[model samples]
Target: MGPSVMKKGLLLIALVVGGGCALFLYAAATRGLSAREAPSAAEAYATRTFRRWAVPANARLLRNPVPPNPETLRHGMEHWADHCATCHANDGSGKTTIGTNLYPKAPDMREKETQSLTDGELYYIIRNGVRMTGMPAWGNPEDGENDHETWTLVLFIRHLPQLGEEEKHLMSTLNPKTPSEIEEERQEEEFLSGKDLSKHKSTNGRKQ
Candidate 1:
């Protein structure tokens, strides 16, 4: 074969290979993009990765002066209902309206994996929002370095497993009546009277 013909054949092969590679990557990207609206394997992986690792760091470094007061829990619950309930759901089931449209899908907090997460870890996730996941960082940039509100939220979320159906309704829609929930609300009103809810723990390892 002529040298010119040989060179042309090699160039053609290279073009085909490149095109194939590009197609594969494009498919993967598009698949992930679509999954954000409806959950796919990729979205599950993203949630797992964030819960396993990302959350811990955010709480330890970003969330400082963690408050252990019961009022903190009450405040957190109120904030959650207003800001997070749309996606996380009232039952801690994590059934957001936007979630139905995602391909990767959001998580259901009522499930064991989410319920088992530590308060500190949950705080970090709330403060620093997971990448590529629907979760957002509600951290306060100015006070985040010493924020403790994030931990308050963690405390409330950790109790998801123990809440009854009635409690879930009130907690999600701003009407909880359980003594503890009621007390939490009262405290929330008192503590949050002059405070904000947009601001922020580290929980690692399975207790069991």
Candidate 2:
């Protein structure tokens, strides 16, 4: 085959393969993509492939302006506890209820699949988020603060496997508390102070 003819044939094959994949994905979506069910091996591979290709080349090459220092990591740790720990957990092991239930599920950042990604790719994903996934676009273009925070988060992600017990404990304290947890703490404090629990119980009963 002539060079031009061979090129045309290759393009045709590429188009056919792409269309077939798209149709397959559409069928899967229509069949009800369940968060509880793990994705098939093929589906998982395709998703990862698409994500890698989706990031722009320039973005992938961009360097992290924020230095990965102790202070930056500390800030990242605090931010992760307050904002990300609900889903990603303090250890970056997406094992929390929300993370586990997400369609396609959150990834364990400490794993090779995540750690192998380029620094810029990680930053881009954090800022823009992956489509058709539970991850949200957390970085705000209008807010420079968000950019700095996200860069720090990337550093913290790199430190996940090396996270210490003390750091986890600090993060646990910083994590947002549910209303029930807050009330439980209050009651515990009152009990420790020898305050009457009967009055609190009667007040709650009246509200109910």
Candidate 3:
């Protein structure tokens, strides 16, 4: 073939391969972020900086969360439904029409297939957020329980896979608040903050 024709053929093949990659990643986008050009040169080479602080590469589920109590679960369910279900989904699959649009994508909790970390790491990720990765920090210095809420969410998440279809259906609207639990919740929310949260709830969480 002529050099000109061969060069044209190679360019077309390159374009097709590049386009396929774009579509593949587009299908993989997580959370609510939009897809566009690929990450910048610096971003492409970047790795998790969270390791400096002991955070893991992937989210970890806790094993013995204190107060795996129903009240905390109720709190987590509510918080997740309002704040997270849009992307992570009520089931934590990180699969949703919205979540799949995000750039780096979201984590799917049920797929213990990909997870490898500790509960503390997951709590830190929830409270401190992962910059540029679409994960948000839950706690502000303002709301005392935001960190508590973060851990609580992680604790609840650890329980996902073990939950039967009935439990999931029930979770669609379950509130752990009996009058007694509500009283405890009201008091706990008023009193807990920072590291102190570790004491009020027990178990820290366990494997699903």
Candidate 4:
């Protein structure tokens, strides 16, 4: 209320922030900066709180323009399968190899920590990505106000809580497979169907 009290409040805030940073640095130094170690509860809370504050106030208030529908949700699911499943997984579990190994590890999107975020916050994170984490910014500067794909993704995130087994199976089909995985599937299918696998061999002796 008064200048003296306002100054004291600011000083107290500054002291808390400085102390937190010092402790973080000490932990990093003592803990040896290992990715395998899960973040402490305090660290996790601070990071989440900081991320929430980092988003612009206006951006947080913005709403998804893409209307949710079966078609749109399918499109979003497909996009997620091809692009996001590597880290987030088809069920938004964030349990894949890459996801589990990250320093902070990818979040379990089905949980309240993620689901509690507003659609706008989700969209912002999807488009802009959080700094100092594995997420990369996906927004194109040219897209401007017409980022329909990102908005649709927000809908899919909301749908994650209700993800069905069939939907996960479809997403697996849509996931980007490595060449070896494709070849393995082909070989398995041929063997199961009793097809002549040898006839498909190439000159290099690799499967055609």
Clashes of each: 18, 0, 18, 0
Lowest lDDT 10-residue stretch of candidate 3:
56-65
Please provide TM-scores, in order, for all candidate models, with all chains considered together: 0.60, 0.78, 0.51, 0.80
Pairs that collide, model 4: none
lDDT of 3 by residue, 1-208 (tens): 9999999999999999999998877777743234634455575445444343556444343343457888888777777767887778777887776677676666577775324446767676676777776777777757533457776787677776665676657655543346877766665775764346445455555222
| lDDT of model 3 at position 125 | 66
Error of 2 at 142 (Å): 2.3
List the candidate 3 regions with Cα displacement exceeding 4 Å.
1-65, 113-115, 142-146, 170-208
Q: Write the per-residue lDDT of candidate 2 for residues 92-137, one digit (tens) a residue.
A: 9999999999888888989999999988999889888888898888
What's model 1's lDDT at 112? 78
CA deviation > 4 Å runs, candidate 4 = 1-30, 192-194, 202-208
Across 107-199, the per-residue lDDT of candidate 1 in tens digits comes to 777677776665556666676777765677796867654566666677667766666776666675673246877756755885779544333
| lDDT string, candidate 4, 1-208, tens digits | 9999999999999999999999999988998787877889999999999999998888888888888999999888998999999999999999999998887999999999999999878988888888999998886867855698888788999999999999999888999999999989988998999987777775348634
- The TM-score between candidate 3 and the true structure equals 0.51
CA lDDT for candidate 3:
0.65
Local distance difference test, each candidate: 0.65, 0.89, 0.65, 0.89
